[model samples]
Target: MAEEQLVTFGLGTEEFGVDIMLVQEIIRIPPITRVPKAPDYVEGVINLRGNVIPVVSLRTRFGMERVEESDLSRIIVLQVQNKVFGIRVDAVTEVLRLDTESIEPPPPVALGMDSHFIRGVGKIGERLLILLNLDNIMGGEINHESA
Candidate 1:
């Protein structure tokens, strides 16, 4: 029975997970410099120890209502395809391991989020975690809505 370690975080009322290996570090929200002409989901860039990493708002990416950042807010730094970026999340819940058998393909609707962003659904007891598909997150063929 192979198990996958995941880092779970909160967005709105739902929970999401990403492979722990992809996570570089988690930090509290830092002062972000807004970038003009960036995508709506792209909140801005942050200076992390001299590294200018772009930050994405998970709420905006999921088309959810934006809320004020609280003490629980965190920025999860992830490395995908040799690129490093940060995702601003409401709160980080916990890290856990789940058996691969517990994961299922994304449903048709995928809880209202674009199915493109979901890799699969993992079930743990009564909790359902939406595993993120990092491949489609950045530098992929993206469709921007007309404002």
Candidate 2:
């Protein structure tokens, strides 16, 4: 069976995983500059080195109530479709490998937010992880908004 490496993180009580290949780097939350007229899920832009990247709040994206950032809060920088962005997560749990056979398609019902954001559901022992479709998370609209 083929195995996929995943970077797991927490959002509220639920856990989510994203393909490690998509992850550029993980860093502590930095000062975010809010964008005018931008989507509510977008926390804002941040300066990493010299490049500016928009940061999306996974909580807001999932329709979950916002919480104050804790020490565990982090931003996972990802590159999807050649556009770089960051996703603010409650806390990063751990990096793990999941067997492809243990994955299932997203459920018919929405998982909190939109169903399209989910790639699949992965099972690891007693845990259920919501795999994310990074492409759909921002889609093409975000690029236009940020530009």
Candidate 3:
């Protein structure tokens, strides 16, 4: 059976995962430079060793209530379609491997804010992971918004 590796993290009480291949690195929350006229979800840009990368708040993107950043907060740097950006998450839990068979299609009721960004739901023992579609999450709309 084929297994897929994921970089799992927390957003509030829920767990989310993305393809490990798409993740460049994970870093603690950094100072972000707010952009003028950027979307609310666009937290701003960050300088990572001279590379200025845009950062988005997943909480805002999902229309969730905002909370104060804590020590567990993280910025997950991801590269999708040649574009690199960071997503602010509550915390990063772990990198896990799940069998492809354990993933199931998302139910219609699961559709919520930016539901299209969800690839599927993975069932691993007692845990449920919301698999993300990185491409869709970092779609062109975000590029246009940040530009």
Error of 1 at 72 (Å): 0.3
Writing each residue's lDDT as its tens digit, candidate 2 over 1-147 gives 899999999999999999999999999999999999898888899999999999999888888999999999999999987889999999999999999999999999857579889989999999999999887787555343434
- TM-scores vs. true structure, each candidate: 0.93, 0.94, 0.93
lDDT of 1 by residue, 48-117 (tens): 9999999999899888999999999999999876789999999999999999999999999888888989
Q: Residue by residue across 4-114, what tens digits does model 3's lDDT show?
A: 999999999899999999999999988899999988889999999999999989999888999999999999999876789999999999999999999998877675756
Against the reference, the lDDT scores of all candidates come to 0.91, 0.91, 0.89
* Root mean square deviation (Cα) for candidate 3: 3.4
**Model 3 clash pairs?**
none
Give Cα distance to truth, residue 89, candidate 3, Å: 0.4
